[model samples]
Target: MTVLLFGITKDIVGSSTLSLPVSSTSRLRTVGELKDYLSSTYPRLRNLSSLAVAVNNSYAEDSDKIDNFDEIALIPPVSGG
Candidate 1:
């Protein structure tokens, strides 16, 4: 699956996009799983106050389903003056 990064998420991951390989034995099925995977892979992500995930352009809940063909994005909390 490919995940787009935005705001601080982009800086944390060090890239604007992230790709995850999918195979029969290992596939991410839920949004929560994706969050766990990312947090584990990029420990710094766990430090963020909040992280929102969008799948196919809509905000997704932890129970939301995900697939390799879906569009995903990580949106970090944004603050402005």
Candidate 2:
């Protein structure tokens, strides 16, 4: 699956997008599992106060299932004047 990073998430990840391999050792079936995998692989992501996952332009819940072809983006907290 390919994940698009935004805001601070992109800076933390050092890339605007990331491609994940779908293997038995690193399976990404649900949003919750993706969070766990990211937290473990990229510790900086855990430091963020708020991180929301958007699937197909809509906010996703932890239980939401994600497929390899789904549009996934990591949206961090944003502020504006």
The whole-model lDDT of each prediction reads 0.91, 0.89
User: For model 2, what is the alpha-carbon lDDT of residue 60?
Assistant: 100
Residue runs of model 2 more than 4 Å from their true location after superposition: 24-26
What is candidate 1's lDDT per residue for 1-81, written digit by digit as tens? 899999988998999999888863157789999999899899999999999999999999999999889999999998999
lDDT accuracy of residue 26 in candidate 1: 59
- Model 2 lDDT at residue 15: 97
Report the C-alpha lDDT of model 2 over 1-81, residue by residue, as the tens digit.
789999999999999998887672257788988888888989999999988999989999989998888888999988998
How many backbone clashes does every candidate have?
A: 0, 0
What TM-score, computed on C-alpha atoms, does each candidate reach? 0.92, 0.91
* Clashing residue pairs in candidate 2 (N, C-alpha, C atoms within 3 angstroms): none
On the 0 to 100 scale, the lDDT of residue 28 in model 2 is 77
